[model samples]
Target: MLGLESLLFLIEVGTLIPLIKTNKIKYNVEEEGGCDDLDQGDNGWKIIHTDVFRFPPFKSLLCAVLGVGAQFLTLATAIIVMALLGMFNIHRHGAINSAAIVLYALTSCVSGYVSCSFYTQINGQRWVWNIILTSALFSAPLFLTWSVVNSVHWWSGSTQALPATTVLLLLGAWVLVGFPLTVIGGIVGKNRAGSFQAPCRTRNIARQIPPQPWYKHTFVHMAIGGFLPFSAISVELYYIFATVWGREHYTLYGILLCVFAILLSVGACISVALTYFLLSGEDYRWWWRSVLSTGSTGLFIFVYSVFYYRNRSSMSGLVQSSEFFGYSLLTALVFSLMLGSVSFWASLAFIRYIYRSLKMD
Candidate 1:
């Protein structure tokens, strides 16, 4: 994406440079012989230079490209190192699950960069909001869900069954390594692009460009783009819990399960992006939209947990509605938080790409 964004920036500049030269030549011709058109002479050149160089669009693009490249490099390096360091094999029994986490983490990095890029493209106004959105949208739900699941006995017992020493070490490592790396990525992504200057060139450009209709694209974007992966993760969570407890198979099929999950993920991405785009009228709304989408998912997950507890009477002991609901909420909360947080940062990077295309300066 960063590479693509950079290439797009070059294209925008290439388009602009010719216009700049043409305007300058026209102005020079009128100014040479006491022409009455000062507006067509030095003034035109001044305006052209201002638009071409002093514009936010150009500066923002530069920042976005550099920042995204930094983040992508960092995350890619971190994951490669993590895998090589035997993080993948740390849990012998949960090798498949662990590997999946690593894979998601890697993919999440891309998502984070893309989303951030897109949001930055729309509204480069609030960095603090961007930071908070990133944290809330991507990290908060996951953290809450994990904390809840670890406390509850309803899901897979792996988190609960782990020795206190191992859990502490794992948490510490995540805090020290995972959190820092993510923070670094966010900082670079946010700070890299300073601003975008919208070109009010002739209304001709705006008139020629058809307005992007919202409804036309929302469903497909949300379904295939966002929800598919979400479905995959949710399904995976279900299996992880079921398998850990050696529960009976209530699944319809294995391949279908994967399909559902991938669909869910794709849907979730589109849902967050489209919802925010509608609310703020700025693609950059991902900063907050990420939070909203994640929160919405959590709400649904919490509700589902309520249903699960009420219907699930086969568990070892009858858990009270309050506790059961709490467990269910935790399940959604953890996954939602994780997903929301991931999407938030990813959305920022994505926004940057959009901004780069628009030539904000």
Candidate 2:
């Protein structure tokens, strides 16, 4: 299964890389901007320059969430790198899970720094409150998911149920380690954060968005955004699903690392491309759209997990199904956060680069 899965993921790499190359070449510009009055190259993404960085609605909250998402994204990559380097044997499930928990708890500082930094960039007023929300929104749901799954396992007399002492210790670890790091990171980020650099001055009032064609709609963008990146990792996803459900060991740390890197590249490219389209259409609400467009890969993954559970390997008990779906949801959420953040940051950078390159008269 792992062999087949590896082959598939590699195949996906071949398919997606070409597509990315084509898009990058097609969209590559050499400093050409036409006036909006004449409407020459105004049809391009540059037309909406003013509103592109108009501080998205709920800007503070979005930044906080993105900050945490970025943190997890980095943490995941670091963990995979460590595994590939033989810091810990990737074959050991217990080791991987333990490492992940410790890393996540300890890495909250990154979340705080990123979230608060962005928040500060947007000139958010309530720094402390914003940081609090960032930590809670990310950690609370995951903790609940874990608790639910553990309770289900405990009810079924499965050893997967973490003992009460261990659960308490996890809570203590979060409070002692995660929370403070987040606060410290938040403080440092806020103090050091610079203003968001927008190439063009944003307007106090927003421009009316024209009705978009069906292809430019959220559903269309979500489908393209989600599936393209998801396709890149679908084969590897099968192995991951199999290991989780089949209770098998995952030892492909090197392949896993490669897949992780490719996924990030694919995510960023797709995001920038899609954001360009949105901006060209004069739709300025791209902040969340960028996140959701790329994050929809998680939704696609969840859908595939349903297929995997139903058709692929078989472990058809209450505890098994519950654990599979529950953890899968968390997995999707994490992917949405991690990869989506990558996409957004890339899009943000691309937008800034392109806008700055233009000669605004």
Instruction: Estimate the TM-score of every prediction.
Output: 0.42, 0.86
Residue 198, candidate 1: Cα error in Å is: 7.3
Let me know the TM-score candidate 1 reaches against the reference structure: 0.42
Index of the highest-TM-score prediction: 2
Tens digits of per-residue lDDT for model 2, 75-192: 8988888877888754566787889989988889999999999999987989999889988977888888888888889999998788899889999999999999999999999999
The stretch of ten residues in a row with the least summed lDDT in candidate 2 is 31-40
RMSD of each: 15.0, 16.8
Q: Pick the candidate with the highest lDDT.
A: 2
User: Candidate 1: misplaced stretches above 4 Å?
Assistant: 1-93, 96-163, 190-241, 244-298, 316-361
